[model samples]
Target: MKNHFLWITFLLILSLNACKSIQEKANDQFLSGQYQYAINSYSQILEEDPDNPEANLAIAESYRLSNRIEKAGPYYEKLAEEDPSFETLYRLGLSLKAQEKPEEAKAAFEKAKGFTQEEEYLAETQRQIEAINLAKGIDNYFPNHVLVNYKDLNTPGADYAPVTSENFIYFTSGRQASGLYPADGTPYTKLFRTRAEGIRVDVGSIQSLPEFQNEEGLNQAAIAISPDGNTIIYARGNSTSPKDIPETALFASYFRGAGFTQPIWMPVNEDETWWNSTPAFSPDGSELYFASNRPGGYGGIDLYKATKLANGDFGNAVNLGPNVNTPGNEMFPRPAADGKFFFSSDGHPGYGKLDLFVAENDASGKQVIKNLGENFNSPNDDFGIFFTEYPKTGFISSNREGGVGDDDIYFFEDKTPKPKIVNVLLNVYTKQRVAGEPDAVLEQARVVLYDSANKQTGGDFSNTNGRVRFTLKPDADFTIIASKSGYFSKSIPYTTVGKTPRPEDLVQEVTNITLDTTIVLDQLILEKSIVLENIYYDLDKADIRPDAAKELDKLVQILKDNPSIRIELSSHTDDRSSDQYNQDLSQRRAQSAVDYIVSQGIDPSRLVAKGYGESQLIIKNAQTEEEHQVNRRTEFKVIEIRE
Candidate 1:
């Protein structure tokens, strides 16, 4: 019986040794950065020993190193519940934040602060708290644009970062999941292309690059084409051996006739350990912007800029500074026209994970960053934006739910309506009288503008169409003087007191309010009789009646307006009156009219009154009452000129 017990104990010892051996093997894979293999091995160990710390921790960290930090949330929750530690709780916060549980994440971070007295650690924890609060404030804002998933281009593997050039669309995708990357268990990304119109990509036209440009077991992604469309720069590199540190570098290619030339390693990559990717060119193609994890940055994966040298090589790299870079990773630098640029970041205040942001110069000319709002971003890995049109239309990438793949491409267009504006303008049509009608438009006539203060604001000549325009201020009064050579000058008053539209009425981006008027000017020619209508006198009286005085007032003002000339005021008689009596009465009537003008503050030297007795009439052979009435009329002409 004792011998039998020893045999059973020997079997138990062997099984225990075998379990230890399997666990050590998985540990080696974890330490060596073989996260995918470690995850698999840890999963096997977890089946038998669900409470094992080493196996659970390896699986969680493996997910993190593979850029799948979201997958670690469940594991971290279990581990923290079992035995909470500073590392476990802090990482738990990150996992919860990635899953869009901000309140829970904040609590985890608050607990983590007590585990350490390090200032940097405490400061980081506070930043997380502050970021969560800031994001809450941003949640109230509507999305600047609406994003549409690329249902046609996305696959089960990762696909992202699409750029446009000419008639083609360029992007990267990982379709082959068989040769899984050790760190991620996903196939390495490769450059892909398809026909496109604007932001729309054709599904059936998708094609991969030649084998040379798409090397096996390597990642070729994050392509940026120059504005000229002749050059393209992309990131292409990954470590095959565990002994070598994983590296990504910028590669360039030039287009010739039909296809792009073989990509050459760029010189800007100074070191293999720099870990550069996601390159973009300035709109002018004079500078290159990209993301890197090199030393001397604000923190993890800060953005950098390098000027294109005269020899076509890039100058030394320079960090984008603190306002843009932060403690967390910042990737995908996309520059737009003007001084604005787009990028993605986790360090900035965002909804969750990495959110796209734009850097713009504010009114004070200082750079400020803004979130893209809730629509284009979510609680997932959102990054890699390429703007097809500035601030409006663009391509984006996200790993949010409802996408076809892990990281899918999307197109966005700004749907926010533009602000309303109301512009008030006055258009004037200047013309002169011809015969009895005002049909002759006076081209080249000078139109002078005056403000409410009576100061000359501006002056301009009428166009060939006899049209002149002036911008009018809301609720203001003004006068315009229209004058031309050999023409009588006149002033017209205009007001825009109630012409403005209410704020609510201006619903369009631009609202135009145009007011128009016409002016008629008479030519100042000597001996050009200017008949004055609506004047009358009693039957045969030589005295000027009250009605006659009213007609004379217009002449009084005309003489006042044209002060440089002397006017002849004349009175005529109808043929019905006897010649001798008409002659005698006409002279008296003319003298009476002139006497009235002299009484109204006019210089006597400027008056020249004449009488025509049945000699000057508007109508001859006056038999009817209407004809006789037309025959008896008053007239004046510029008989004398002082100019």
Candidate 2:
């Protein structure tokens, strides 16, 4: 009995020490601004002591600070139900406001205003109510656009901050399970790149940038590339600091010799006390824009600009001033090439926590601000606007509902009405001419397109249906060339220049007028005499003339189109010289034709040179000059078909 009593006393002392340890840890985490960790620690204490007011309050405050306001609402609601303090009611109202429940938030703020005695608290409560009222009617001023989530790049984590360079998109993502920060139990964000086709990004090609990844602690994000694409600026968080609240600083790196150099912190970075992030460079690379919470700002986070010095360093940072910055956070400043500034703000009247806004100088040189509207902004945080070369399409980052992650990137494009387009459909066929049969589809025939200037525009091989389609510009002329091996090439001219618009076409907004046409190519048969009309040697010389080369080019096209067919190029001569001399000259001429075809990318094995000097002639007893000219000619016959 004496030993049992001692064991019970030991257990009570251990329990008291555990409770004290948890309270100390929770308080330490809260002071360090690691709200997620603090919530975990405080919840552990509350599990054993359900009625502990300190633990309950710490958990609720942590959730609020961590931007998990929806989760914080229930804790604050329970406390208000039990004790109804002014502070609890005020915080609950802010939580409701962040969740976009303006009606409920206004009521809570009104009740809190009645209970608060401090002038500062009463003024803030009134401001909160007014802000909620403004938010209720802000949707009427938004622009029309379509928001599409980036299904390829997002995971069940934070994926945002997209910037485009050429054909690749550089973004930030905390998708890796490892390298998580202990403060929030969330993975550290790292810079990544993926290839994009137009506005569609290939997620499977996402690759981590090795020069910016931090294996030990927090890494870089919010990338901004220079106009030349040789330089990059980003925000690197200082997670290795021993202090409670870590800060992020701006850094720049140059892409040199096919790889990026080591990133160096910008000289404009203030001592670790200030947080600077979301860097954006002007199109000319003369100025750098970023967000900073440093001293002397208009509000929570103000936009600042630093001019690029002659020696490649930055000048003193200057705030954008009251016209742009406000009491709430202003971040993600993107300067478009078209002299427009875009940023996110909560201080301005918006639809949600952080709505995207555009600022541009009007004709009078006054800065005009406009909200992006309901299409782009949601009830959740939406920022990070990135525009492509095309003005109508761009990307935005949002943590809205139905996202694959906490903050997923979305692509937005303006699909307003535009002029109708026309389509040209080409059907390619091969004319076999097998005694009495019709033409058939020429599968895999090469179809090339050329504009009126004879410059090659685009080309594609015919599919199984022997068809190809091209969206030609209206009021233009084009030439379509179809060629196949063992066959003659054919060129067809198409023009939409003289086409008159139909009566119904004038009324439609957008329409695709399909103009269909068919082209036929004749096959080159074996043992057939096809005399080259202009292939004439000069004065008994074997040297080919320019006129002969023009005719032989047709043969080159035939060889290229019919790659599997072997042909014999034969040369015939009139009975004017000795048999041996005529035979030698004819052989040289035939070899010359074969050499020219080989130089034009046709395989040498596919061609054979033969000379029939006066032995095989079209005109047996040549008397007239025209008959003699026809006797001396060059012709090619399909000797063998490989397929």
Candidate 3:
């Protein structure tokens, strides 16, 4: 009896200490706005005492804040799995939708409607489910969410650009588990890899890319792995350039074997003042598309393609030409299995910087770029796209405000479309019945184009040519309204065929109308450059921050979009700093920007990073604090480039 009592007392004390420790950690993290950490702390308590309702609720709240809805599923599911409370069921629906399981996600949403007056959330879920259903062209929605996280040492930094092969995923990262190391004392970035263990639903464990590691240079970012997982092509550059030092030309290695053999650079014929990076091998591995800043471009950087010869040498890179190479920058070239090219660009109108876009290669082999619409875009930077080999699920990276750093990865599965979009076209003209050179409406009219339901479709206004072109979703209804300041908006209704057409869905626009040109309006197209009030690092420090990455990404996007645009990345430091130290810091900082741009697939030749240091001080004779602040700055100016 004495021994039993002693053991019970010891257990009680231990439990109390554990609970106290958890509470303290939770409070600390909560006060610090580290909700994820706080929730993790609370989770430990729940693990010990499963009935801790407060802990469960805290986890749910954290999940909501962090947009980790799938994580909230079990807590809510536990409450609703049996009798199903209205709150629990509603949350369950949200959780499932977040998991990208729309059908089951919809069922949970519908079930919640049976108990609560708050049907708004459920209604939204239903609408999304419906939209996904329609978009996928499926009778019943399929649950296709695969968990993909590539782990290993030889893998480069954050194994990203995951290209799925039937049962495996080929990706790039800088981790060393694969035993690859960069030459020189340079910080490491290498393309290490792994294989997925299980079927589509459960993406099991990852096995190291044993064959690819410890090569000559570190194979870091921008990977294009073949669909069969037998081949890989990735970007690599000199470590002396550092992460921010943009190279005049970036090199790529063609990887063979389950593990890579001695990879070779894609010959110097593609080399120009600009760098060649972000190599994407086609599904057949016979073709390659990459970004380059060589001369004869539209403006900044452009995507180019080269054919693989039977001798394993690449043919001269053919310029993708005007259709695909805009005056703006284009990078992250991904050739989808369906023959469409998916890439990230800033030249096209999108939600924000570096939006992901898809383009179809016409029968004539011309590239036509189209935005993926709003679902996959946000107001912040989005890039680094790759899909899982499992047919639909995969990941992407973005620094769009809500992530932990400059770039955060997101996993999404294909929301199959029900009815497909066959084709779509919109025309803008001065509203008048006059047949030839009709001139009744306002000139330079600003037209805001929208999709079928009035959501913004990515398109531009009537150019001097007075025309706007767009690709349409199949089997979808589209409405277009054209307006000037004074004229009543003209609404045009059109529908596209879902399946093989009965020939009824196609329509031609001959309808004409006269518009009132009386309403005068001022339209301003804002093309704003990011302004740095002041750029300063700690004394003698050269490390780049996540915030700097955001700004650099914007600059990079601009360069990629405008193929002919060239700019010098200038770095400056405060006059108070020693001249030599300031100069070195400035140079490193400028180089850092260049390095990041090169990593993002921008051709380095287009950019020149210079360390101005205190040489270009904005304020002369810095006696006051405010004037001294002016000496620290970084700026860019466009240089000569081809049209």
TM-score of each: 0.68, 0.60, 0.37
RMSD of each predicted structure: 12.0, 20.0, 33.7
The lDDT of each candidate is 0.82, 0.77, 0.58
| Per-residue lDDT of model 2, residues 1-643, tens digit only | 0011121122122333457887777777777777788888878987897656666677787776566766777778777777777777887887787788888878888888777687866866786777666665655233556789988778888899998887889988897646766455677788889888667888788888654544346756899988888888899884856753367888888877878878887888766668899999887989999999888887778999999988786778999998788767899998878788899987676765788988888899999777777888877789998888446788899999999978898998776656554444434343333546777777777888889998887888887888776667667788888877766667777887756375355665555566767777777677776676788888878887888888898888766655667888999999888899889889999998888778778889988999988888788888999999888989888778787
Q: What is the lDDT of candidate 1?
A: 0.82
Model 1 agreement with the true structure over 1-643: per-residue lDDT tens digits: 0011121122122232337777777776666667888888878888898876656776887787677877898777777788777677777888889888999999999998887787777788899889999997664123667899988789988999999888788998997533666777778888888888878778897888542357777778999888898788999876576554458899898877887889887888878778889999998998999998887887778899999888877778899999999988899998877777889999999988899888898899999888878887898988998877766787899999999978999998888866576667789989998986647888999998899999997789999999999887777889888888798778778888889888777767787899998878888898888878887888778777888889888788777767787888888889987887877777778888899999997898998878888887678887899898887888888878786
Q: Which ten residues in a row have the lowest lDDT in candidate 1?
A: 1-10
Candidate 1 contains a number of clashing pairs equal to 0
User: Which pairs clash (backbone N, Cα, C closer than 3 Å) in model 2?
Assistant: 142-373, 484-561, 485-561, 485-562, 486-562
Candidate with the larger TM-score of 1 and 2: 1
Candidate 1: regions farther than 4 A off: 1-18, 139-144, 176-178, 210-212, 239-245, 254-261, 416-643
Candidate 3 Cα deviation (angstroms), residue 337: 4.3
Minimal lDDT window, size 10, model 2: 1-10
Give me candidate 2's TM-score against the actual structure. 0.60
Taking all chains together, the TM-score of candidate 3 against the true structure is 0.37
Q: Which predicted model would earn the best TM-score?
A: 1
